[model samples]
Target: MKKILYLFLIFLHFSCADAQTFDGSWKGEVNVSGQKLLLVFNLKKDSNANWVGTFESPMQTSLKFPINTIKTHEDSISMDVKAIGLSYTGYLDRDKDVMKGVMKQGNFESAMILVRSENEQSGLSRKQDVFPPYDYIEQDVSFQNAKGNASLAGTLTYPKGGGSFSAVILVNGSGQQNRDSEVFGHRPFKVLADHLSKNGFAVLRYDDRGIGGSKGEVNLATTIDFASDANAAVDFLSKQQMVKTGKIGIIGHSEGALIAEIVAAENDKVNYIALLSGPVLKGDSLLILQSYALGKVAGLSEPALEANKLNNRKLYDILLRDEPPKVLAESLEKELIRQNNGNALTSDMKVKLSPMLIPWFKTFLRIDPAYYLKQVKVPVFASFGGKDIQVPANENIYALQRLHLNTTDVTIKDYPNLNHLFQNAQTGKIEEYFENQESFNEQLMDDLTKWLKLKTK
Candidate 1:
């Protein structure tokens, strides 16, 4: 009888252990549009009754993510991870075996879900092949523009054969992006140039005016002013004996896309245009959308977000009224104080905001890419990433549809899993941007290659 009782106690102990426990690695998948991406959370319990883990993604080529803090109460748990330039937070299940919550960055938010992992496989499938290496030539040249004789600096990537070939000029979006538009340690323009050249197309990508080794001030320039620089690049390409001058095209990203539209409208020399994550709507609408994105990512309350939108609209109105920069700056400072609990403005924020508001607003208000896109007579290929928070895919497509351009000749492809920078992105806070290496959406590149082939034929 004593032996039987001891055995029964042992069985009860084992059953309790199995019933009260919740610990193990968890896996989840986020589906954006039609693209499926995998995410893994390796959760383990520590001595202090806390859970810890690491998040890994097969799509990220840079580094592994460490989960820093995890806290739990009776029926609720929270997890926090800090990687790159962003922070992620999520709420765990009552049993602590699953996580079903939202993730946040500075001003972005997304639904997050995790389940117990059954196997040790990594989150997403890895790519079997990588981009081929190619040789490149770096050059510094000057071009005549409406602003003056501005100096331009960039690298030219050519195929191994060295004969004249179809070429493309890369154009950057807004801000003071360098020739390569370096982001998160990735030079996308350089990468594209190398890829295209290896595939038999010559490529030229240069820094904008006042950036990198280029000469001039971009702060005083307008969208039309930038268009002149693109025209100069086209002129230079036209003169290059090593390039098929009539087959040269312009590939613009973001704000650069607007410039490409203007260039194609004014100059008939451009054979093709590729607009990557470009804006099709007026600048004011874009700003509102950007603000809304920021509000979501930042976790702003409904009231706070509405207030911010009102403030932004006020600033837009002031700018549209043509107020002097100083007056506008002062008004913005006052508004910022009100927004921030009456705190004084930081010098860095003030400096960054002052010169940026008037010039950018003026330029954005004056240029409507749709009008110019309607005038474009050449082939156009435009792409937008569905996960891109800065430029919403629906708005961009709607703008294109309104242009009523040759739908047959205009190609617009939306990659469901990509970001504004054309990278394969996971569903998370916008802060994930600074933490990952830049990657181009494979589908976008494939579509581009196919469209270019069709255009050249």
Candidate 2:
């Protein structure tokens, strides 16, 4: 749910007459949503005689993303994916071309096998992403969030010959994203911005602070800090000659939805708000539910899953204590050790669990969306995917229905079979996000555009 597998690594066997070297084409299948995705990696020696590797996936457009931190010893290899917190360690078989290893990202790791392949294939197709035939004006835009000491850059798309048109700001969910909310080559924000701009609305979708063209440190920032970035965006929009003043709205996805709620509640400048797959539960409850749901989908055993839940609750409780962060981290480390023995947490598990001690996560555990929702008086449109394990549609929809019961101009709709990214999906697994070609669902765009038109008119 938390941008699981922004990058996936699978170690594949290298077959040359000489099995001692890892230079050649390697292929492996990545299992996602009951589908097998072919991942190919090309490893070679550069002119400097150092080993370099590039990754390719049938589902993505980029044929090669360079692999960093490559370390090779006779028959064993290890590497890290550049620009993301992902690492891989694998051992080669002396008798075969096969390599067995685990891919670790954050605290999640999965066992993978690499097979020797002579050729790479690109078979997956994106039937839904809009490529450039410019139905609207699009420009690279930069703005500042002075409070956070960050300069954010993004794409601003609007109808050509605009005259004070209604505008919307697209806010990304958790994790670092670059304007497009791009994952697995699917750019939902790009698709959304294009759709809305063509329909006569202006849209600004920007990179998170410290990512892409944006400049700032994200480690110390919280959701409230991100809301300040949105506030700055509103200021920027107001200054745009083509944007109508006091008519800016926000469409936030996942954690971005929470940030939008915070902004809309406090800032009267946000006229309308759309929450996509937003959590309805308080922070702690949401975390617990997310863990349970994802674990369930991964087919985790009941006892092991319950142990994880207990450990998570204890850790979240520890985060709220009046103690210094160092002290809290120590406490968490001790608890993790205890939990690992009382039950086992795989090496990958540690990668997943380590974030709980961070300041952003601590702040997240203490806040409740209800607190902000009660204060928001603007028109609200909240949509959830029925199969969203991340936010769990029924819980969010019900919570919003109850919270907005007395508030006028609130609409909540659940789209069946759509995943967290709003892709029409099967099983709604995180891996499906990469496998599916459609960016933003067409029905969703229609619903959102229709609502925005009515609200602005």
Candidate 3:
């Protein structure tokens, strides 16, 4: 999931090569896992003859990014996008119209090719994506999370000629997400909100704190803080003239599902709730499971994986103990050394691992969703994708089904071939997510709309 979280961040950091040999548009395709995405770099010589460049990926997003640190020598071209720990090394053709390269980010490598292209449109083929002239009312809105001292900006969509409609707030997963929960060039929440709005339900999708139009310090916030934001959304929506208090609900995805559990359990105004690719286990346990699952897909040997899991479990136990962060970081460093046979992790790895010591992850590592679910009394709908590697569907579905709920009603649905985003998928691998252009599965929209209509009525 972090990979998906960083994919766009890396894409945003770009660079070109020497002005002489690379002063033109260069288009390339990056094969990430099994998915292929197009990237374009348009480079030019500034007044000083130094190379300046901009990047575009029509298949990913329409935004163009300014890039730096482009270098070239003979037939070799390279760019260091240090912002996301990425480097691209390529060979230019004699005609200087094409550049073939390998992009390395962290430990992952992908083949990339850049050809000269000036007229390439956004190649993304999203059949379910909604465009302008919408039949529904769409408005940009902002609300206050008084407790968190944050202002959240979002889009509100509802049927134009509506009676008081049942409404749902769409909560995004982890990391810094905007209103649409954009990832890999696909806006899942936007597609979902469109569907639900068309089905006679108002939907609100907002940016996470400290992102986009929202205002706050996201790095200092935790899941509990995020719940407060959602609670505020509920409060705001309840006061809307077109929304009835008891008919407002939440649809939380991934980490947002956990926050929804917190909000739903504590707020009586929540009539119903939906969990999409939600976690059912404690954070530490889920991390171990996720590590093993994703590691296997990456062809990690069983013995090495078991060793890694064991080391992680021990570290998690240490994290829960009353120890200073300095001591814990030192201890973790020792553990990493032991796990890697005295090979120390790089400085970057240490920095990356710093999140494990943060207040958010520490709190998350201790959370038990079952504890929150047991307190919820609202109607609940939990869905999982069978091929979801991030949140394994069977474990989550089974855990949700087995919860000792005091809820009004509980419904669990499983999609055998869908990935975390509910796309009909081949391997349920994260890489496959970018390859498929379908935003949200049609069946998922139908099922969710049908359930919401029935529950609200």
Candidate 4:
């Protein structure tokens, strides 16, 4: 379920000028499964002379966000992303013009170094991101998610000369994604939309309600709310003149794939659904698998891996309780301390466990995809990336295959070399996702469209 949409491993090193203050860009790299991922920290002094900054992994766009108020003592520096209970503590190596430390989150920590960034580039372009001379028609459109009080903005693409065609709504996975569903400069959604549009299938790729031109409040909403917006898109598509009646379907990736099932099962107008790198396991189960895979690749020792798993299972168990908010917070905090061998909860631990109390993470803990998948009484198509550590094909595909869906056309395929984003990958690590230039695989697009062509009106 990455953006699993949760874990972004940071192996950092601090590089900065030997200035009196930490007032510049810093960078580092952590090797995950033999892939290099770049990390950055941008620090500046506020009017109060307090140091504040943001943590960034340029390769993983979703990993960039502001850290908590930084506290420095003598030559020591510290910062935490309180929401996820992750923290960085370092001490200046003035002689070496660097800072050395560890990036800690959950039960894992990695050696960190920070150095001055020498004009690092942020925008990575892909070969398939080519513009103009398109053989299709593209239109900007918006629809009302009346129930959620939002407007869903998106691009509608279809064959230029096709009389009429079936329509498919593309849903984004985790994180705040636009219609392009871009990450690390890759616009797979745009590439996929164009491919489908040019191949006689109409594709509607939209911004998440609060993203891009769409309007809504995302902070308090969970997957259920997003499903409502998708249903609204279905309503809008059904009314389009070029769309065949009752021929609307949805194609979702990652968390979006789980969502597509929800919309399909509940919305009668949806004739079919296609899940691209979708997660079928329960949220907690998927996270467990994701953790093991990532830990293995990060070269975590066996004892450390097992300990982390034990902690996660305990955390999920605590999260699944339907107690009052106050009660849950106390219980969860206690569990965290106990998990830390009865030590008091650290500032980072408090920050990290805070997300577990939110609407989305809480809902994700116990919600089972089968509840919706079994209700989907329409054709289904699902594909997985053989190397997708986030939502590994072996785990999810097997889970999906075990389910006897309500419909018959339950087509599922696993591409041996693809990642969660459906790009051709070497190791399919986060590093690869940030480094690869291919937005999407052409061959997979063809296969997906070929399947979609038959499912459409």
Candidate 5:
């Protein structure tokens, strides 16, 4: 689910800028997920006296962002990025060395402080540039399926030697993720590809049909339709001379994990499967848990949290009836208004809800993970983060245990400190997502490598 903070950040970035003189590097910090994250801002005054600035997180490049309006009265100054979906209403101190203000993003608001910095900021670069050093060939490939013309584009990493190697295909979770499922300046798939390839496993990861350089409309496709794309990837891997034909498998994360299950159930060519934070429960239940957790983390009031839960349950009830999308959308809007007087959602919320809610909920609510799990003849391994707010670990693990398939070959491990993206953090708040470096847990990666080695042998 897209969080309000993300939308606000986008809005704040594109807002119009007004005249003001801002000419210095400033630094600030916020406590997120129990750890303090450093945020740096560099503002410069142009010849036109317009203030231009860039926002930078630690170890990420400064991204150019415009201020919608800037006002300076003596030493007191203020700026706002209405386009970035963020507004800063604050005052500069008498000494002009500090700017203290409040930042409002959607319904959430917090205080912010900026202090002048004397030295040039370091450790700020694009996340893609952090990929482990490796030699690889980038390629654009396409294949046809029942879902119309579909294409795949990604980097194919190979080991130092030229001999045939064990291979794995990467599958991303929900949303229109690129080949790397890039988020918060991190490319987990690219990191995984480098690490696995260097360890002698040929890896094939590609952009979703409509993402990156790939072709096709993702909105028109369903999960089953996506499974076809994964199937095509498996077929492509099987035909590769450098990939052991009978040894190719899949490693899917979140929603992609479910797609992997469907592919493995239907295809004999796939030899092994790994589910990273895959859900075993129905889609509606998963959403409820996710909503509840997020609300708790954000310190939502009891009445507000209960209202959300009730509305979600009501929405699920309507979905179970398999009503028309239009009717369901109307009903959901009515319910939202009843709960929060139409003030609960922004325009973006209303626009995104219909398309995202109907089809996804319909398919997900009807899916039974065991149906696919029971049909899989290949070995399977699954893992979830104990602190995952998106997918409950206990519920998913219990469902996996109940599968009729050979439980002996199924392994479930939970990392207590990891978040949905497999990064270690003290808390699992979604807003803290962009605050940290993007990297997978070392222990989980080690365990997966070991299991793959054993399976190939």
Candidate 6:
């Protein structure tokens, strides 16, 4: 659930030079597997006269990634978002005043033409976004993850002038995120928190360590370590005046769902949990399945999908090893070559991979939610998106059939057209997330809250 290589939620930042006429925003649409995703580029010259730019998916307005380098020669421009293995080459057409380009990442390629556009954020007028005149009291809060030397920052909301309410903490999935668990301008956590707080439940959602106002590092931490943070949140919530002591719960998404299982099993403070698109399979298997599913959705050929599966399986095996970073890198490089027919690792390839050699990914590679789920004695609600390519429901939920929980208040629901982010989706592909206007699916939230009211009350 780390949202690494296979996940294509992208961001780009570059700039136009004084010599080039690329000082304005450019818009285009790229076709991936019969779906159209709008791509925007914002290029301007900074005070230093430096060419700077940014890429936006008005729909996936979650990232503003920094590019490695941008090179320009006359009307031609090239840049690389090395972090996501994305690169682009474009030439300006004077007559049309458009930038025609080709974007390449791994085995995928698409041609695009960008026309001038003034809109900075499009497809963001969502119906679910919360605004002024709240029925709940929202406040900034913080708590110590003493074990991790972290002071986590969060927003807590509850019904105004209410009794001690049943409380739930929102846990995030993969990738670094703020308190809202925002993805592509979609804040599922914020929307869920708003809805829950209005429904007479206290909700607390926080930034990940080393992200936002939180004062901790996630570089060296594992899932178990994050559970410590969640446990600390439970402790903080349990002591809050507005929270019912015996009614504390957690709502985890993706990787956070695994953390929820760990905390619910180990921490008595948690009375219930809600899992959104959580993985039931072991980490390794989940990642493998994720890759295959993503490939299939992208319309990869059978042979290509098979080759990618074999390649990722080998790389994951290397990650499962406990060797040092250097050793692991060497093994990973060798496997990469073998998987690619002896092709050497390019600099860009290494740049994209350097981040994966860390501890979080390694630990996640072997994490098994079932090991902790079996021990969870609290009330549980696990929901999956039928179209969720990241954590496919048919397979992951099927794995749950093998689980025999100790809690009788368990609830499991599947949304046929929802994606990993719980949005109403067309293809459930990652790229499709930004195109939709809905943040968290209304039906899923309604059902989940109904279940919470029953179990918590």
RMSD of 4: 9.5
| lDDT string, candidate 6, 83-155, tens digits | 7787788766421234556887799887555655444554445678888689999999999988878899999
The TM-score that candidate 6 achieves is 0.78
| Per-residue lDDT of 51 in model 1 | 77
Rate residue 431 of model 2 by lDDT. Answer: 51
lDDT of 4 at 27: 64
Q: What is the C-alpha lDDT of each candidate?
A: 0.64, 0.75, 0.75, 0.75, 0.67, 0.75
Candidate 5 wrong stretches, greater than 4 Å: 1-66, 70-142, 301-304, 341-349, 356-358
Mind giving the per-residue lDDT tens digits that candidate 5 earns over 225-254?
778888988887888888886898899998
Report the poorest 10 consecutive residues by lDDT, candidate 5.
6-15
Candidate 6 root-mean-square deviation in Å: 9.8
Error of 2 at 108 (Å): 21
Give the count of colliding residue pairs in each prediction: 4, 6, 3, 18, 15, 8
Q: What TM-score, over all chains together, does every model reach?
A: 0.67, 0.76, 0.78, 0.77, 0.73, 0.78
lDDT of 2 by residue, 257-334 (tens): 998889998888889999999877988878777776666675556875686678778877888898997888778767
lDDT of 4 by residue, 1-457 (tens): 1112322221111222224456666665553432345677788888997788787766767666888868876556788988668788876542223455677778767655665533444445588995878898889998898898988889998877657788899998876678888665567889888888877778898888655788887768788888898899999988888888877889998888888999998889999898988889998888877877766665556886687777778877877887897998898777767766677865634644555667777777677999899999998889998988788899788889899888878998899999878888876655566557788888888888888878763
RMSD in Å for all candidates: 15.0, 9.2, 9.4, 9.5, 9.8, 9.8
Instruction: Please write out the lDDT profile of model 1 over residues 22-86, one tens digit for every residue.
Output: 36666654433323345566667779856767767665543567887766543334666677433
User: Over all chains combined, what TM-score does candidate 5 have?
Assistant: 0.73
The lDDT of model 4 is 0.75
* Candidate 4 Cα misplacement greater than 4 A, ranges: 1-123
How far in Å is the alpha carbon of 323 misplaced in model 2? Answer: 1.0
Q: What lDDT score goes with residue 128 in model 6?
A: 86
Candidate 1 ranges with C-alpha deviation above 4 Å: 1-147, 330-358, 406-408
